[model samples]
Target: MVTSIILMNVERSKINEVAQQLADTEGVSEVFSVSGTYDLVAICRVPTNDDLSELVTRGLLTIDAILKTETMLAFKAFSRHDLETMFTIGLDGI
Candidate 1:
C-alpha cells in the first residue's frame, strides 16, 4: 500500500466540514484536527502511486476550502501495533 500523510491548510470557517469530507473520502484512513502550522492532517492508504496521485489531485485538492496541502509519501512504517499483532498472530485461541 502507498501511504501518504497529507497536511492541509483549510479556511478557518470550514475546518470541521473539510475534515469530515476528507474522512469520508475513499483511500483516506484518518483525518485529524491539529494545532500547528497546518489545520488538519489526513492519513491515506491506497493501492498504487497512481491512485495516490488521483486522490490528491482530483479528490483532495478539489475541495474548495482546502487552501494548500503538503503530501508526504511513506517509504516504511514502524508501529508498535504492528509489532504486537505480529507477535500475537495465532494466540487468540489461548
Candidate 2:
C-alpha cells in the first residue's frame, strides 16, 4: 500500500464540510480537522502511484472548498496497531 498525507487549507466557512467529504472519499482512510497553518489533514492509501495521483489531483483538488494542499508521501510506516497485531498472532483465544 502507498500512503500519503495531505495538509489542506479550505475556505474558512467550509472546513468541516470539506473534511467530511474527504473522509467519505474512496482511497482516503482518514481526515482530521486540525489547528495550525492548515485547517485539515487527510490520510490516503492506495494500491499504486497512479491511483494516488488520480485521488489527489482529480478527486481531492476538485472539491470546491479546498484552497491549497501540501502532500507528503510516506516511505515507511510504524504503528502501535501493527506491533500489537504482530505480538498477538496465534493468541486469539487466550
lDDT of 2 by residue, 1-94 (tens): 8999999989999988898899889999889998899999998999999999999889986799999999999998775344455568696634
What are the clashing pairs of model 1? Answer: none
CA error at residue 51 for candidate 1, angstroms: 0.1
- For each candidate, the alpha-carbon lDDT, in order, equals 0.92, 0.90
Among these predictions, the greatest TM-score belongs to 1
Per-residue lDDT, model 2, residue 10, is 93
Q: lDDT per residue, candidate 1, 1-94, as tens digits?
A: 9999999999999999999999899999889999999999999999999999999999986799999999999999785344445567696633
| Model 2 pairs whose backbones collide | none
Which ranges of candidate 1 are over 4 A from the true structure? 80-94
Report how far off residue 89 is in candidate 2 (Å).
17
Worst 10 residues of 1 by lDDT: 79-88
